[model samples]
Target: MLSCVVLWSGRRGSRELPRLRPRVAPTSLTRVDFTELVPEPIAFLGQAAYIQLEAFENLARAVATAPSLGAKEGLSAAAGVALRKHHDLIAELRRSGVEPVEVMAPFAPATDRFREASVGADWYELLLGIYVTTGMLDGFFARLSEGLPNELADRVRRILAEEGASQVLRHELERAIAEQPGLADRLALWGRSLVGDTLLVARSALRAAEPSGRIDEDVEPVFTELIADHTRRMDALGLTA
Candidate 1:
């Protein structure tokens, strides 16, 4: 089963972004045997495709609202890359003999909720949100791809490995923070706030045989790596994670 809850919290500059709490109940303190878990092929393809599509859509919107021509161009380029990834995933879905739309439909609501709740209140926040969230999720999906059938896994990894606008987004964020040093603190908090919601989305993508859809304890290390990567991304921007 899936459930979502949003909590509002005040931030620096009085801005607020709603946090999406995880659906799974809290992890038990006791240790348990590890069981490897991987989402089924269709679930993997559908979720991966939808995320790229959402990234493209969000970046396209960012392009429109960007404060300068340079930012607009950079974001437009990033959006194009995301769109291309989406198309590639859709093609893979077709090759597997499933309708793209139907395969992707089941994931739309949860992913959409994630996007909406995590959206930033301004250009800086929005850009940071895009940078932080997408980087984390891409790392996640790429890792999950390993558990897929060999050929499909290779294809998915290659597609995700294609360079996107991480540099552009990073440059833009660093510039913003440098210009207004105060933004570092706020953006750092914003980046920290995003982890729970982002991880929840990642957890939901796992294929669970249990009726409750709880994640296996074995997956904790994967999440640990994802969090570490997220911290590095934040550090690269000179922000605390």
Candidate 2:
């Protein structure tokens, strides 16, 4: 269920239950039409790809305009790697028969809303936002890909496998935070805000994708694990969880 959200978002972009194992498509789920099920997840992946591309491009442009030659070089390297990953993911979606435009259309509003809500005031905040959002999406997708059909699952795995942009962002963030010692607490708060906005957008996305009321029990654990992973990521960044 949460994988659906993760996969769906992958086309775009957890908690834990105690004693809980991740859900496999129950035998009963085998009868449910995968074609019907797959569309939403694919849609998510498309939207996510678009958002990542847009954000990275924006970041690259910003860095290019800055006075720092070193920053520009870092941005160039990271953007090159990130773009390749996104292109590959998009190509895989096409091979899987996903209609990129139509699939991604519905998710635009939610993703856009998230972007709007998370507009950072400065470069550091903006960079951290990118890091938090991408990491969160990637973590969820990595866990959820297991339940997908092989072809689709393979694409998800590939997309999550890269540490390109986020790794670059983390290095930049560490440097920025080190330079301005007081920025850490403020950025930590900003990170929390990003998590909140992501959940809101995710919930909106789940509702749009699932059109059937609340998420079912099978997916509940996956959501738990996703949140837990998100917390760990925040901690890794020296943010308050």
Candidate 3:
């Protein structure tokens, strides 16, 4: 597919945020589709992406209204920044053929997957992960930017008060496993797949980012490292079980 990314802001004050990090390998992207992009990652961690987006936005607004954490603002404002940049991340990824998983469009359906499945939703930690991951992605994007754009970074810090969605999900999942006992194996296996698939697909983002703009080589190594570290954590937690 040959196309140009047109980021036409419908409103003013719509700054052109940081571009994507780098190019992904075409070979890596060849067999993937939008659905495969977001698997039922480790007890459905992929679902957390959308939830966290919401978490940060809520926090941002709160901060704007009342001073908190000694910053004179809440987390909502910060999430706004990340949400705005997420648009760019999608553009950059799609331009090079890394389409987002469409089923997550509203970011609500995934929540239903675990809403009443006996797992208490750890809203807190997932919220935190949302903030942290936003920061990680934002920082990587900024460094890979033409001028090291930090728009995403700002939003991430703003949502700093909250815990990551992953942590919450992990805790809940752990509890579920502890009680079920028999389900542990499945969860652990699923967790491994999530980690594996994430790395495999991640390459496409790298190649996708390459042609349209210049991304720091440093960005990929860092991103890869983060994913690996995250995967290790999940593995230790037995997410697949």
Candidate 4:
């Protein structure tokens, strides 16, 4: 969904940097200046990430239903990429400012849950939600894509129609859930972790920044309600424990 990469060099003195990239930050952290419009660069970049979630959730259903062993494993890998992309973006934002990442840390996924194999079900469920959230927000991209060369818009639309990434996530979810009976519990816990950590980091960002903290609509109540629904569904599925 991201059309191009903009690499940002962290803030220097009182001067703010500019948005430069769609990224995967280094495994070993790096620091840079804060760009003035770091989070909302090319409108679609932010928008696409938001709406990709719709496709993700739908695909998760496919994962739950897939019949092949190969197909199930595939969903896991695809979901992992989607999750990482999200992590990298937020990580990039935090790392760019003069502040240390630890001070404004993003999601810190539970090490233990990921370490155990039992968490596969939870992983698919959460992956689905993340996809749904991202996809729901993607609707705005049409406006963002407007005025671009016709070729780009056409290409993006084609990719969307195919639901490329979400398809991969679904394939894996089906396999994971079918094979990992306890996956539902594990995924529910993971979803809780994603929501909680996101809130913690969000509040921190809101507090640290000025009047209008986050401009993106996808980060607002609509997204929160969806997350709540996801949580409720998990509870209903008897994964509360």
* lDDT scores in order: 0.77, 0.61, 0.37, 0.38
Please, what is the TM-score per model?
0.83, 0.72, 0.36, 0.34
The sequence of per-residue lDDT tens digits that candidate 3 reaches over residues 1-241 is 1111112222332323322232452223333122212222211222334444544454454345332353322244454554554454444335435445663464454333322221212332333233333333333333333221244334333333333333433444455567776565654443333332232223323333444333334333434443434544555555421
Worst 10 residues of 1 by lDDT: 1-10
Q: Write down the lDDT that model 1 would get.
A: 0.77
Candidate 4 lDDT over 73-121, as tens digits, reads 6664555554444443334334445332342223123212222222234
Best by lDDT: 1
Which ranges in model 1 have alpha carbons more than 4 Å from their true place? 1-36, 208-214
lDDT, model 4: 0.38
Cα lDDT of model 1 by residue, 1-241, tens digit: 1122223222122322323344343232233212234558787888999999988878988899999999999999999999999999999999999999999998899889888866788989888888988998998888778767888988999999988978889999989999996899898888888887787777667533212355444455555556667878888998876
- Runs in model 4 deviating more than 4 A are 1-40, 43-69, 72-162, 198-220, 225-241
In model 1, what lDDT does residue 156 have? Answer: 92
Candidate 4: deviation at residue 163, Å? 0.7
lDDT of 2: 0.61
